[model samples]
Target: MNTDVDRVVAHLDPGPGPGMTEGAHALMREIITAEPAPAPRPARRRRPVLRLALPGVALATAAFVALSWLLPTGPGFGPGPAAALDIREENGYYVVEVKDLYAGPDRYQEQLRGVGLDVTLRLTPSTPSMVGSIFPTSPTDHRYLDEIKTIDQPGACEKMGGCPIGVKVPVGFQGPAEITLGREAAPGEEYANVTSFDALGEPMHCVAFRGRTVAEVRELLAQRGLAVHEFRDTNPYIDEEAASRTSVPDSWYVNGGYLRAPGKANLNVSEQPEESDAGGLRNCAAPQGS
Candidate 1:
C-alpha cells in the first residue's frame, strides 16, 4: 500500500505482453511490500512496456529490480562478485583475503581493480616474525593510512608472532598507493625487511652480541653454526654500499647484527664504542666485557 509501490504497480502494463502466472504475481506482491517506501524523487518519463516471451522470467526480473531499488546502495553495499579474492563487506571496510599469495603482482592488481580499488600489491620475502604483515609505501599519508588494516585469526596470529592473515581497506578508499605483504622466504633468499637481531623468533634472538668485538661475535656465530656475510657500520650517515665493501678489523666493536639469510649474519660494527658505552669502554674491550 506504500506510495512507491503504488507508482511501481501503476507502471505495470496489462497490455499484449506475455501473461505472468499466478505464482509470479504473488512473488511480485511480496517483493513490492518487502520494504518501506523510499523518499520521493523528481518525476521522470515513463518507460516503454517490456514485451517478453517468458512471462515468469520477466515478472521475476521486475520483482528483483524492485527489491534492489529498496535495498541500500551505499559505498560498501555495491554489487560485485567475490572471485579471485574473497572480498566481503564489514563495518565500512572491505575484508580481503588473498586467494593466492604466490600469484604474480599483476594478478593481484587485476583483482583489486575489479573491485573498484586502485591498489598495487607486492608479496615480499620476510623473516619469520614479520610474515603476513602489511606495509603501505606511503607511511606519511594519514588520510588512508588509518583505514588500511591487517586482519588476523584469533589464535593463529598469536602463534605466528602476531602477524595478520588478511588485509582490510576502507570501502570509500581512492588510492594510488602500493601495499606490501610479507611472505615466507624461499631458501637462500634475503629478507626484505630488517628485523631486530633479538626480535622474537629471529635467528639471533637472546644472543648477547651487542658491544662485543667482531672476532668474539664471529666465534659466537661459529658456535651457533652461522657465519658473518658482511660487516656494516652503525653510523647512520655512512653510505651503506661503501661500508659493505670496506674492510673491517676484527677488533672493531659489534653494535648489532641481523640474519641476512639462513646461515649468514650481517653485523653493525663501529670503530668507537656505541654512544651508550662511551663512558664504559673508550677502546674495543675484550669480548668478555659487555
Candidate 2:
C-alpha cells in the first residue's frame, strides 16, 4: 500500500503559477486508484480536522493575489482630464453639449473627433437672438446659415449648467463645422453681444475657391486691390501648433484663412476642401469686454 501511494505521489510535479501539467492530472488518477479501502476496525474518537490539498490551494490563492495586483483602480483607469463636452446621437444627427463654460476650442474639437465628425464650436459674440448660431461659411460669406435654422431648442436637462450649448451635426458629415455663440456683454453695456455681420454689409462668399492656398487668395485679393489685413488660419485642432503671427504670414498655414476686411473689399478664404465647413474669416470690431 505504501509503495502504491508513493507511486501516485511521484507522478505529481506542479508547474509554476496556476498551470498544472498533464503529469499532475495523471498523479490525481494514480492517487484515486492507489487509495486502499477502509478495513473493519473498532471506531476511535478523534478530533475533527479539515483536510485540503495545501499546494493546489496555495497556488490558487497566489494567482488571485497576482491578478488583484495587476488590475487597475481609480476613475475608469484612463488618461487625460475629464472631457468637458458630451456627445450623443439624436435622430440622424450628432448632438454635442458643452458642459464647461471655459473649455478650450481645441479640446472641443478633439472631443468631437471621437464622434466621427469634424465639427467645432467657438464662442464668438453675436446678437441676442442670433446667439448660439451656426456659421457654415467663412466670416466673409454673407450667405445665411440654414443649419441653425433646423435646430429647435430642447427642454433643459439636469446636467446643463450656465454654459448649455447643444449643437446638432449630421451623422455622415466628415468636414469641419463651426458653431458661434454669443458672449454676454460686460457691465455698462446695453446689449448682449455683436457679430461680424451685425453692422457690416454682407461680405463676398468664396465657396467657389476652396482649394486655393492663403498666398493664392492673398494674391487674388491683392490683384483686385483689396487689402487683406491680419490673415490667419482657423483650425481649432491645429490652432496651438500654428506659427506665430510674427514668425510666419497667414499664407504659410494650410487650413482656412481669415483677413481683416478693410473698407468694403469682401475677401474670405477657407482651407477646407468643402465649402460647407468654413468660417472665422473677417475684420469685425468686437465689442469690448464681451
Candidate 3:
C-alpha cells in the first residue's frame, strides 16, 4: 500500500470546473458590495392631542353629573314627602288614607304639614257611612262626637261615590288642633278611633269615664243619646302578645273594660269586680283615643 500511495495521489483528477469564470464572479461581487444600506428611521412620536383630549372629556363628564345633582328633577322623580301614605292636599285640607293603624299623632301632623297645614288626626273605628269623612266640630267643644257632621262635602261625596279621608280648617287657619277619623276594625280586632278636638287643640270631653260597670257606663251614654256599637271586655294578660306586635300602645282596647259610641272611638271604662257591690257612675270619664 505504501509503495502505491504517491502514484495514486498524483494520478487523481479534481471535480468539474465552476460554472462562472473568476472574472464574472468578481464583477458580480463588486456590484453587490458597491450599494450602501439605508439609514434606520426614528421611532414615531405620540400625538399630544390624545393626552389633552382625555382630561377635557373627563371634565365634561364631571360637569354633567354635577348639574344633574344640582338641578331639581321633573314630576317623574318618585314622589313627594307624604306620598308613602298617599297623603295630598285637596281643597283647603290635607287628605290622608288610613292605611296603617300605627300612624301616630306626631306622624299624622307631620304629614299634614307637608300640604301646608298644622293639625293632628285621631283615628277611630267608623261605620260604613262615616268612613272617609272629616268632621269640623268646634275645637272648643267635643260634644259633636255623638252627632254625624261633615265639612260641607258629605252630600257631594255621596254623589261622587268615593271614600276619601279629608280635613277642614278655617281660611288662613294656622293652629294646633286635633281631628277625628273612623277606621274599621280588622277581622278579629275591635274597632278603634279618635275623639274630635277644638281649634285650641284641647280635648273637648273626657275620654276615659270611670264607671262602676259597663252596664252603668252604657246607661249613662244611652241617656245622653249616644249609640253604642260594640262592647269589649279586655284581659290585660291576653293583650301582652298583641301589644308586642305593634309599635305604639294599644289605643283601641284597654285592659279593663271597653265601650263604643256611634261617631266616637272605642271607649275604655273600668268595671266593678265580680264580687264587688260597688254601683253607679260618680264622675266617670270616657276613655280617649291616642
Candidate 4:
C-alpha cells in the first residue's frame, strides 16, 4: 500500500498531504479469519456428578437457538452513529442506507434496475444540473420513487423517529434506521438509518453506505444456517482499506499515463467477476467528514 502511495506521490509534484497520507491506515480485509491456535490438550476430568443436568442443558441450548431465529430477519438496520451502515440477514439479502450527500437520483435508479433489483426509490427535492440522476430510468421506477419520497419525506414515519425518508442533513434521525413497513417489511423488508454516508465508502471496505446498500446488493452467500455479522466495534479487517479526502493524491502526487508497450499475455483462466460488485470510476466511495 505504501509503495502504491509513493508511486502516486511521485506522479504528483506537490504532496496532497504534508505527510499524513503516510499516516493513513490500511484497508480491512474481506473478513477476519484469525489464525486458529493449536488445539488445546484434553485435560483429565471426572464425569459430571449429575446426569440429569445434561438434558436440561441440551434443552436450554435448543431454546437459545430457537429464539435467535425469531429475531428480526434483517441486520441492524436502524438508526446509528455507525462508522458504516449495514443491512444483513442470515437467510440472504440486505439493505444499505446513507444520508446527506449530492447525487444524481435518476441516474442511480436506472443503474440499479439494469442490475435487476425491483427498486424502491425515495427521491429528494434537490435538482441536479437539470439533467437528473441516472441510477434508474424506468418511468414506473421514477413514479414509484417520486411518490415514496414525497410521502415519506414530509410526514413523520412510525418508529424511524422522523420522516420515513431521512437524509444526513435531517434532524431527529436517531431511531430505527429501517422501520418494517407493510407485509414485506413485516418479516424483514426495511431500510436503515443515517448519520453520514461518508466513511462507509472507503476503498476495500466491502460494507459501505455509498450510492447503494451493500448487504442487499450481494449475491446469496447460500451458506444456510450461517449467522450474519452486521456490526463490529473497531476490529479493523485490513484488506478493506479506504482512502481519505486528505488522502487524495495532489497534482504533485497522483499521476497517470497510457499503458506501456502493451503486449498482452493471455492464457485464458480468467476469473468470473462478481455480479453485484460496485465497479466504477468515481470519487472515493466515501469522502472524509467535513
Candidate 5:
C-alpha cells in the first residue's frame, strides 16, 4: 500500500514468469543472492525517474529502426510499426512501448528491456522498408514535429545609452511547440493516451492508444465520465491524403488554448473531424522526435 513497500515487493516478488522453474538448488542460490532490497521511501515522497529511453520491444525495434529508418518523412516506414505505440501486457500490467525508430546506436540500446517480460514488436509483412518513411515519395506531414527552444527577451537589460529613449521589443521566454501524438496513435479504450499543449507545460498534443480491444477501450472512457469519440488529423498540419483517412468528427476536445483538435481528444487515426478550428493542430506539418 506504500511506495517503499511497493518497490521492494516488485523485486522481491517479481512474479512467477512464464515457464520459469528452479532447475536445481543451483538456480535458487543465484536467484536468492542476486541483490539486496533497497531502502524504502516514505509513503508521501515522490520517487526518482523511471524512463529516459523507452522500454521493452520498442528498444529492439528502435535499434533496427534507427539503423534502417534514419529520418523518416512520413508514415508506413521505420520498421513499419515494429515499435508501435501500444498499451500492452507487461509484468501483468499494461505499459506502453515505443520501438526505437529514431534512437542512435549508442542510445536506447540496453535501457528498454522489461525485467520479467519477453516482449517484442512485430510488423506486418505488407509494411514498407524503414527508409520509406524517411524518404517519402509524395512529401509527408511529419518533418518538424519535435523541436524545443528557450529564448530571452532582447531588451530586458538594454538602455538607450543614457539617452531618454524607450525600447519596443518583448522579453524572451521558453516555449515548446505542442506535439501531435494522434497523428500516429489513436485513442481506444483498451489503451488510450492524451496529450495537449498543457501537458507538463509544453505546446504538444497527441494520441496514443493500445488496449485489449477497441470496444473495451470505449468502456473505460465511459467509466471516467468521458465520452469515447473518434480522432481526425484535419488540422493544418496533416497531409491531404492522410487526413482523409484519419478524421474524427463526432467527439469533443480540440482547438482551445490547450488541445488542437479539441473536444474529447478522441481523434481516430482513420476518420473525420467532428468540429474544426483554423490554425489548429495539423498532422502533415512535422513529426516530433523526428
Candidate 6:
C-alpha cells in the first residue's frame, strides 16, 4: 500500500510554484512512507479504493507546502538567544534593567556587547546606604561619566529598600567605559566602600566619640554590644607596623570610626589631639552616646 502511494506522489507535478523548503520535503516524504493500518474484515464483498485516499494525502501535502514558504529559513530560524540584561529603548536612551545583581561581570559584558556598547560592569559589596548606587570606574573619560544615568524608583531607597533598579545610556554611545554597582554584602563580608559609623541608619549614628580617649570609646562601643576590630590612622605617612598593633595606649584620642561589619568597628585613633580631630567629625548635640 505504501509503494502504491509513493508511485502516485512521484507522478504528481509540484511544478511552477514556490520551491518547497527542506522541512516541507521531509514532511512530504514522511506522509508518503507512513505505513497503512491492517485491512478490516468486510461484512459484504468490497474492493479497497486507493483513489479515495489519494485526494486527502494530496491536500495535506499542498497545505504543508504553503506553510513552508512562510517559515523563516537560514540563521534566524527560531527564537533568538536569551539575554542576561533586559535592555530597552526609552526617550532616546538604552535603559538597562538589572535582572540579577549577583551575576558575574562577564555575563553582563557579553550582553552589553550585543547592543554595540563596549562597557564593563562590576558588582561590588557595599553597605546599606551605598547599595544600589552606580559609580564610574573609567579614569580617562570623565566627561562621559555624567552621560550615564542611574535610575531608581522615588523614595524606594529610604522607604521600601528598593533602589537603583537600572541605568540609562544615551543612544549611539561608543564607549570603552567601566562602571561599578553596589550590591549587598555577604555574611561577615567587609564593604568595598567606606561607610561612616555616624551616618544615618548606622549603628553609631548619634554616638559622639570624637576627641574622646580610646578607653572612653571602648566603653561606648561596649554599651552598644560592639567591639573595635582594628584601629586605623588617618595620617598616610604613619608607620604600618606600629599602626597595626593590637594594643594602643588608653590615652590615645578617638578621631572617627567606621563599621567593618555587623558588630565590628574600625576606629581611627591617634596619639596627638591635633591629628585626631582633623577630619570633620559629626557633632551630636542631642542626648548623645548610643
Who is ahead in TM-score, 1 or 4? Answer: 1
- Residues 51-144 of candidate 5: C-alpha lDDT, one tens digit per residue: 1000011111322332221111122222233443322332223232234433332222122132222222221100010001110010122222
TM-score-superior candidate, 1 or 5: 1
Q: What digit string (tens of lDDT, one per residue) describes model 1 on residues 37-81? A: 111111232212211111000001322321111111123433345
lDDT per residue as tens, model 6, 1-290: 11222111111111211222333233334544422211111123221111101111000122222111011011211223554455656666765544555567677777677667777765555444445444332334332255666554344233111234455677776676666554555677654433456544345655767788889889988888789877766455766444544457899887777555567777777787654354335533353543
How far is 198's C-alpha from truth in model 1 (Å)? 2.2
Q: Candidate 2 at residue 278, lDDT?
A: 45
What TM-score, to 2 decimals, does candidate 2 have? 0.31
> What C-alpha lDDT does candidate 4 achieve relative to the native structure?
0.18
Among all windows of 10 consecutive residues in model 6, the one with the lowest summed lDDT is 50-59
**Candidate 3 residue lDDT tens string, 64-117:** 321110111112223355432345344443334433444555665555565555
Q: lDDT for each of the candidates?
A: 0.47, 0.32, 0.29, 0.18, 0.22, 0.47
Q: State every prediction's TM-score relative to the real structure.
A: 0.55, 0.31, 0.30, 0.16, 0.17, 0.59
Candidate with top TM-score is 6
Candidate 6 at residue 140, lDDT? 42
Candidate 4 matches the true fold with a TM-score of 0.16
Q: What's the true lDDT of residue 199 in model 3?
A: 6
**Residue lDDT tens for model 4, 1-290:** 01111011100001111111111101111111211111111123211110000000000122232111011113444424421222223334333332212223354344323333344333221101100111111232111121112112223211111212221111221221211111000122111111111111111122222222223211111121122222111113322222111111111111111100011100101022223323412224443221
Candidate 2 positional error at 140, Å: 12
Alpha-carbon deviation at 200 in model 1, angstroms? 4.0
In angstroms, how far off is 173's CA in candidate 2?
Answer: 0.7
Better of 1 and 2 by TM-score: 1
Point to the candidate with the largest lDDT.
Answer: 6
* lDDT, candidate 2, 6-106, per-residue tens: 11111111111122223323333433332111111111321111110111000012223211101111222222457655556656666544444345667
